[model samples]
Target: MPPNPTSYDTASEMAGGPGTLEGMKRLWTPAWIARHVAMVVLVVGFLCLGWWQVTRAASGNTLSFGYAIEWPVFAGFVVFVWWREVRHTLRGTRTERPTPAPSATAGSEPAAATAGVRRPVRVSRVPVPGDGVQDGDLAEYNRYLSWLNANPDAKPGDYPG
Candidate 1:
């Protein structure tokens, strides 16, 4: 009989196979633990800040500048960290798969892709009468027509209609 193939395949396909908890524990990697810890820290920090502010308001504080002052500083730090994490994610830091790099061959497709393609956007064109009225005046004219149509029994001199 042929020897059993190795359980592991590609880096992306690595997963906990059916076995004892010890085997699974070995696969519980440091990166995974760090991810979970980071998530918990973010959630807990947000909740604590919200709870503190609510408590402060309930305590009948005359002003809210204390929370406001610190909120921006805290928010800025979070935003900076999140941006770096996103950049790393886009760069595929965790995955072993290599992203396809642009080819050196000069072609229209590559040039268009790199230089960016411009799409023609359709804009609504309401033709204004050359001698009739300015485009801005059409709004008031529409209002008048709508009023007249709604109140057919009312005379022209009557309020609006």
Candidate 2:
């Protein structure tokens, strides 16, 4: 069964399918009309610029040849972006969401400090014999790290070698 037109999830669907005359009419809204006008102006402006570059190139400014090609490519990019935005507007899908502010309490730690923060986990490693590293050196390094972790305020030079 065909879905009821009025029961659509988006404004575009409510007007009609995207390619239909009715749907196109929806694009005539003030904001969309402004966008349409802007796109037209940009495309025309770019083409004119390209044409100017082409004339300059013909007059023997070699650099203008590259500019002539670039301006037209810029026009194509503007059209592509405009088309993408139009499609997204028609789909009525939002790309971003508002983030909630962190809450604070009297005599409590700041939310920023606790939120999304993880404490590092200590892993114990068993020394493999004949791994080219002396086991005694590995054990001494592990002991040094443990001492550093335990005495957060102590300077490295304070550790007895």
How much lDDT does each candidate structure score? 0.59, 0.81
Off by over 4 Å in 1: 1-29, 63-65, 68-80, 92-161
lDDT of 1 at 156: 73
Model 1 lDDT tens row, 1-161? 75456964343333432243433453347974675477557756865775677678668874554773465557556657755664454334333555566675765354334347576799879864587656677777888878888889988788442
For model 1 the local lDDT of residue 26 reads 38
RMSD of 2: 14.6
Q: State the displacement of the C-alpha of residue 135, model 2, in Å, after optimal TM-score superposition.
A: 37
On a 0 to 1 TM-score scale, where does candidate 2 land against the true structure?
A: 0.47
Q: Looking at model 1, which ten-residue stretch has the lowest summed lDDT?
A: 11-20
